[model samples]
Target: MAKYIDLQTFTDARGNLTVVEKILPFDIKRVFYIYGVDETERGHHRHKKTVQAAIALNGSCRIMNHAGEGLPLEEFTLDKPSKCLIIDPEDFHWMDNFTKDCILMVFASEYYDKDDYIFEPYKQI
Candidate 1:
């Protein structure tokens, strides 16, 4: 399952601020941003242990969730800057239907390691 997090935002004459703490149930060890993707679908795997949070910064997009929990796939629309999707470990995830100039900022609780990820997709049996 996924967790929708409401980030704290402050606005004034200068600009707006969305605050995120890297501590609590876990700590942030990696951060990255995605942009300039029109037809590309990113992320097709589940982490072995790392947990992640995805935040949309620019345009809107759809996130696909397919965790191996004997349930159907789910879709989430992320369009707000303060809206975040918290992806649990072993939750197979992907992104699609990105609007132009879409930016998705991701924060993770672990470093990037090829061995720490599962990339096999579901197959009919």
Candidate 2:
């Protein structure tokens, strides 16, 4: 199942600082970011073993996810740097409706492996 996680943020006189330290269930092995996206949507598959935590570092985007096993489709908006979305292995997700300055940072549990990806989206039940 995919869920939202609130990252710890410290606001002082200077500015605000958010941290992604011990809150994740798995240690991150891969990190990536998405930006300069066009009108098209991104991410149409799910990983077999990789779990991901996605954070919007700059702007905002909408994530539509469908977890298997007769679960209903779910939607999430990542509009804040302190908000993280944990994508489990069984969750099929796609991102769209991104703002111009959106910078989505993703932390994965495993390194890039083409064979680990399942490219099929779930059919609506």
Candidate 3:
């Protein structure tokens, strides 16, 4: 299942600082970001073993996920830098409805491997 995590944030006169430490279930082996997106949606697949933690570093976006067959679809909004979404291997997911300035950063548990990707969305039940 996909779950939301609240990252620790410190606020002061300067500004706010959010940290991602000892929160993710897996060690980040790869990092990536998505920006400059248009009307089209992104992500419509699940991984074999990779786990990902997605954060909205700049603006906001919406994530839709399906755990598996017979499971209900889950929707989440990444609107804050302190909000993290954990995407498990079994969770078929896609991202959409992004703000123009949205910057989404993902921390992956494994390096890029084309063979690990399963380009299939779960059928809603």
Best by TM-score: 3
Model 2 global lDDT (CA atoms, 0 to 1): 0.96
lDDT of 2 by residue, 1-125 (tens): 99999999999999999999999999999999999998999998999999999999999999999998577999999999999999999899999999999999999999999999998878877
Clash counts for the predictions, in order: 0, 0, 0
Every model: Cα RMSD to truth: 2.2, 0.7, 0.6
Residues 12-125, candidate 1: write the lDDT tens digits: 999999888643257889999999997989998888899999989989899998767566788898998888998988788899999997899999889999899898865412
Q: Go through the candidates in order and give each one's C-alpha lDDT.
A: 0.85, 0.96, 0.96
- What stretches of model 1 exceed 4 Å from their correct place? 22-24, 122-125
TM per prediction: 0.89, 0.98, 0.98
With a 3 Å backbone cut-off (N, CA, C), the pairs that clash in candidate 1 are none
User: Cα lDDT of model 1 overall?
Assistant: 0.85
The alpha-carbon root-mean-square deviation between model 3 and the true structure, to one decimal in Å, is 0.6
Native-to-model Cα distance after best TM-score fit, residue 112 in candidate 3, in Å: 0.3
